[model samples]
Target: MSYKKVSLIVLGSEAALKRALITVIIGGDEAAKSSYLKESEIYENNNYKIIYTPDLNKPSKDIKSVFVYNKDHDRSLLVVKEGFSTGEVWKQIEELHKLTGKSTEEFIVVLPLIHEHTESYPFTCLKISNLFSTISKMAEDRRQKATSTSHADHPDDPMKVAGKPSDSRVNLVLLGMSGSGKSASGNTILGKTIFPSKASSSPVTAECQAEDKEIGSSWVRVIDTPDIFDDDINDFTKKQHVNKCKELSEHGSTVYLLVMHVSRFTDGERNILRKLGEAFGSKVHEQTLILFTRENDLMQGDMTQGAFIHSLTPDLKKIVTKCDNRCVWFENKAPSSGQVERLMHVVHQMLIFRNNSAGSWWRFSR
Candidate 1:
C-alpha cells in the first residue's frame, strides 16, 4: 500500500520523529545507536513508522495525540511504557472502540512486550509480527480507492485509525508464597540481580520494589513484593504491604503468577488466596495462574511434580482448578532461568482476554 502520511509514536523527541506519525516509544537505548550509526548499519525497520522519544508527552504536534486507548471500531495497537494499566489506559480504547461501532473482537488492541526488554529491543523481532499484523488488518479494512493515492489524502490505511495501543513497554510482576522463589523469579524476569532473596526463607520481601528495564526493543518493569501473608508482621504492616501491592499493580498486571513450591503445599500458600481475594478479589483467583518453583523437586523424588499435584488432597485440586489450571514450572536454580517468554505470553493472553470480556464491552456500550 502506498502511503503518504504515516505517524510513528516514540517515547522521546528526536530529529528522526518528523518523518513519522507516531513513535511506538521503546524506552531503552536510542542514544547508543551511535555504535551502529557510526557504521551506517542502524537496524531500523517496522510495519509502522516509529518516532523515538523518551516519554509520552512528546509525540509530534500535527498527528492526533491520545494518551490512552479508548473506543469502539478503534482498530489500532497501543505501545505503552512497562506496567501499563488496562483499567487506566483502556478508557481511550473504550472511546475509540465506541467510534468503530464493532464488537470488541472486530477491532483488536495488543500490547506486544509486557515489559522493557533491552537485550532484544531496538533491533529485535520479538512479537512484532502479531503487532504489525493488527495494523496491517486495520490498514486493509480502511483501504481506499486505488486510483488517487496522494499525500493530500494519505492513502486509505486502516492502521491509520484515530487511536491505537502503544508497544513500547512491558509489565511483569513477581508473586508467590514466602520462600517460594518470588524474588528469584523477579530477578530472572528482569535478567538482573536487582533484588535480594533466598530460598526457604520467611518474609524476606518487606515491600514492593520496581525497576525499569528494556527487553530487546521493549520496555519492561518488574515489581517484587513481600510475601502474601507474612506472619512476622502485625496487622498494620500487613495492610501496608497489601496497599503497596495494589498501588504497584494498579497498572499493567496482565497475569497473577501464584508461584508455589512443587515439593510442599503449606498454609502460607493457602493464605495467598485469601490475600488475593482482598487485593484483587475472588475473581482474581480465576485469573491467577500457578507457577511451580524448584525444578529439583521433580528430579529428587519418584513422584514427579505433575504426579504430586495429581495425587494432591481434594482441597488442593480444587484450589488449582479454581485458578483455571493455568500453571507452569520454572527452575530458578540458575540464572537465565526457565519460562520468561512463556510467562509473559500467558500474561499477554490474559490481558487480551480481559479486554474482550463483558466488563470492558459494557463500559463502551453503556
Candidate 2:
C-alpha cells in the first residue's frame, strides 16, 4: 500500500484524527469477508480480538476488539476507491480531520467493502488481506502517536517522575542460562543482528548488554544478561548482574523474557524460576514470559510446540504456568519478522496489562 493511501486512511480526515474506528474498504469476490476473516485468524492467534461486522450502523464499543466490516458504509474516514473523486475525498477527509482537536475516544474503526466489479473505479484498491495488513499497521501508528501526544500534553510532574514511568518504552530483559540463546533472542526481538550469537561451551554474554528498537508504535529495549542465576556463578557477580538489570529497567515498563532451550531441561532449570524471584522479587513472574529457543528440538520429538510445553514435567509446568502461561518459541539460527512481530505482540500485551493494574503497574501471580 502506498504511504499516501495509509495517510489518507489514517490522517486524511479531520474527523478521523480523533476517530476510533480504522475503517477499511475491501474489494473482491463474494468471499471477501470470509477471506478477510480467515486472514484475521493470524491476528486472533496473537491474542487480538477481531470483531466481524456486516453492519456498521451498530458498532460495538469493545475496546479490546479490532473491528472488520464490509459494505459501503458511510464513515468519516477518507475514501480511496478507484474512479472516486480525489477532490471530494480530500475535502471530506479534511473535514473529518477537524473532529480530532480534543478527541479522547480510543475505540473506533470503520472498514467498508466494494466488490471487484467496482475495480475500474479510478483509484486502485488492494485485496482484503493487503488492505487489512495496511490498516492494522496504520492503526498501531495512530495509537502510538496519540499516546505520545497525550504524554506530551500532560507531562508527568517532576516530583512524581521517580514513582511513575516517565518513558513509555517497553524494557525487555532476556534472562536465562548462558548459551540459552539470550543473545540470539535479543537479536530476534530487534529484527537485526545487533547482538552477537554463537555456539559456546562457556558463558558468551558475560555482562549485560542492551539495544533498543522501535517496534510497531512503541520503543522496545532488549537487555541480554548472563546466566546470573546459575549456581556456578559467584554470588558477588550475580548480585551485580541483578542490580544492573534493575537499573536498566528503572525508568520504563519492563517485561522479562526468560529464555531457555526448548529441549534442554537441566537440574539448574528446575529451580530457575524460584531463583528469579529471589534475585528480583516474588512478583517478578508477573512481568516475565518464557521464551523457548531451538524449536526444532520439539519437532524432532514429533510434537507441536504447544503439546511439548504441556507435556513438560510438573516442575517445568509449574514454572511455565506461573508466568500466566505466556511463552514464545524461536529458532535462533534463523530469524523471521513474523516471529519478531509475534513476540512484540506479547510484549505489548504485557505492557498494557502492567499499566492497567492497580498501584503497582504489575500484578502478582495469582
Candidate 3:
C-alpha cells in the first residue's frame, strides 16, 4: 500500500535500470528472463506499478498512455545515473516538465545508492533502495496539502469554524421501508418539519432529501431517503436512491437511523439490516442506530423500551444486536422536546465512542 504509481525517467543505461527494476519487483538477486521487460514498458506487482522510459527526450506526451494511474498513485520519479551533475538533473526535470506538463514538485529525484552529490535541489532526493518509502512520504504530503487547501477554500464551513474536524460532522441518514415514519423522525431530529411526513398507504418523499442544523454545537445533516430496500422497486431506481444517499452523506460521519414502527414490523423489514449491508457495506451495522417510531403506542401498551426489546422476535432482536443495542424510540407527534434531545444525546455518545475507539469515524464508500 505504501508504493505509489510512478512514472520513472531513467537517465542511465536501459540495461542497468532494467536490472534494478527486476530486483525491486522480484525482491531477490536471482536471475530471470528479460521477457517480462520485452512484454511491455510498464512493470507492476501488487505493491506498485512503474511506467518507465530511458529516452528523456522522447518521453510520452501523455503519461496515461504508458500506464493508467489509479487513485492511490500519481507521483513521478527521476532516476539519475552515477556521475550526473545537479545541474543536469534539474535540466532533465525541466525537460520532463515540458514534455509531460507536470509540475516539478510532482517528481521525486532519485540518486544512485552510492553517490557524492551533497548539494540539495528543489526536489526531494532519495537513494534508489528507498524509492518506495520516498514515494509514500510524497503521497502523504500531497494528502496533507489537499486537506489544508480545502480548509482554506471553505473557511465558512460550520465544522471548521466550530473548531471540529470536518469529518466529525454527523450525518443522520434515515433508512427503512416506506410508511415507516422516517420523515417524521427526521423532523424530530431537526426540531422542525423539514421533510414531508404524513400517514399514507403509498410512499411519501419519493427521493432523498437532506437538511442541516446545529445540534449540541455540532452541525448534523439529516437525510430522509425513499424506500431503497423495497423489493417492488426496480434495481436501477433503487440504485439511484442508494447512490443519492451516499452522495449526501459523503462529507461527514454517517449514522444510519433504521426507522421502524414500534407496533408493526413488516415482513420486508425482517431482513432490513442485511439489505442495508448489501446496499452499503458489511460494516454498515457498526454505524447504524435502530429508531422505532410511534413511541406512544408502546407507552399505551404500558411496556418499557427494555421490556419491548426483550420481547422482540428472534430475527428482530438479531438486527438490534447487530447495532449493539443502540435503540431510540420517538413520539414524533408529541409536543415535548425531551424525545428529540434524548435522541441527540444517544447520537452524540455514539459519535464520541466511535471517535475514541476508531481514530477515523465512518465514511460512506463511494
Candidate 4:
C-alpha cells in the first residue's frame, strides 16, 4: 500500500494565493524557493495537493489536510501572516478580529512580512526571529488575560480576589488652581503633549480627562482634573469634576499632585490645603504631594530647590508640612524625564507607606 502526502488548502482565491506565494518565493533563498514550488505543485493536484478556495467549499472526498481560510469563520486553527515595520502586531491582530466581527480561535501562528528585495540570510534570519518573539509575547499576554478573566468570573471573596492583584497601575491626579500649570504638569507626567496649556485667565481643562502610560514594570495612569476649587466655578460643577476623578481612581490606587506655580502664589493658594482637606477627607494630606512648576524661576533667582522650598511663605510652608514635606518641582517650559522619574520615586514611596499602614485608604469625597 502507498500513502499520499497531505497538502494544506489555503483559504483564498487561487490567483491571490499565487501572487502572495510569488512574493514570498522571490524574497527567500534557493532552499525556500524550491520548497515553495513543491508546495505549489501539491495544491495543483488534488491527489496530494493543497487547495486554494475563496470559501469553504464542500467536497465529495474527505480531505484530512489543513485548510487555510481567507477569513476567520470561528475556525479552530488559524495562521495570521502579517508584515509591517511600525505599530504593534498584537494590536493589529485585535483590530482585524474586531473589523471582521468574529470570534477567533486561540490556536494561531504569525509569519513575518517578507521583503521581496531582501537576499541576505542574516537580515532574513533577524526578521524571522523578531516575528517569533512577537508571537511568543502575544501568547504569553493571552494566557495571562485568560487566567485573570477566569479568576474574575469565579470570585472567592467579596472585597478582593483569591490571588494578588495583577495590575501594576498607578493613578496620578493633578489638582490645582486655574493657570497653575496643572494641565502642563499632566502633560509632563504622561510624557506627551496631550493636555492643552496656554496663557488664559480661565481654566484650560474644563473637565476631568485621563491618559495611561507604562513605566518600567508599572503602568502610570495620569488624570487631569479641572480647577475644581476655583471660586469662579460653582459648587455643583466642582463636585461633578471631583466625582469624575474618583471614578478614574476606582481601578487603582491614587496619588494627588497639588500643582502650583513656582513664581506665582496667589491668595487662593493660601488656604488650598485646608480646602482640599474639607473637599476630600482630613487624611487627604497624606495622599497629596505639592508639585511646584516653573523651576526656571528658581534658576533665574539663583536659588537652590531645597533652599527655595524651605524659604516658602508661611502659608505655603504650612501646606507642605501638611503633606508630610512631600514635594517636587518641574520646569513647565523645559519638561524632562528626570523630573518625572523623581516624581515617580515619591509616588512609589507613598504607595509603600499606604500599603504598610493599616486602615489607610485614599480619602476621596463621595
Better of 1 and 4 by TM-score: 4
Tell how far residue 46 is off in model 3, in angstroms: 45
User: In candidate 1, what are the lDDT values of residues 5-25, reduced to their tens digit?
Assistant: 223332212233221212222
Model 4 gets an lDDT of 0.57
Task: Write down the worst ten-residue block by lDDT for model 3.
Answer: 357-366
1 versus 3: better TM-score goes to: 3
Per-model TM-score versus the true fold: 0.50, 0.58, 0.54, 0.53
lDDT of each: 0.50, 0.57, 0.67, 0.57
lDDT per residue (tens digit) for residues 132-216 in model 4: 2333344345445545343345354322333325354688999999888988888887777989889997667888998777653
The RMSD (Cα, Å) of candidate 1 is 18.5
Write the residue-wise lDDT of candidate 2 on 1-366 in tens digits: 212122221222222211212221221111222223321221121112223322221222321122223122112223233234545643433333343321212212222222123324322333322344455576655444544343433233432321333476678999998878999889878878887788988888878888766666456678989888789878999999999988877777788899988878788888998899999899999899999999877778788765676588998889988887777789877766667765765665565444342211111122
Q: Whose lDDT is greatest here?
A: 3
In angstroms, give how far residue 135 of model 1 lies from its true place. 17
lDDT of 3: 0.67
Q: Which candidate achieves the best TM-score against the true structure?
A: 2
Number of backbone-clashing residue pairs for each candidate, in the order shown: 71, 23, 0, 5
Q: Which parts of model 3 are misplaced by more than 4 Å?
A: 1-165, 355-366
Q: By lDDT, highest first, what's the ranking?
A: 3, 4, 2, 1
- The CA lDDT at 126 in model 1 is 28
Which residue ranges in model 4 land beyond 4 Å of their true spot?
1-167, 355-366
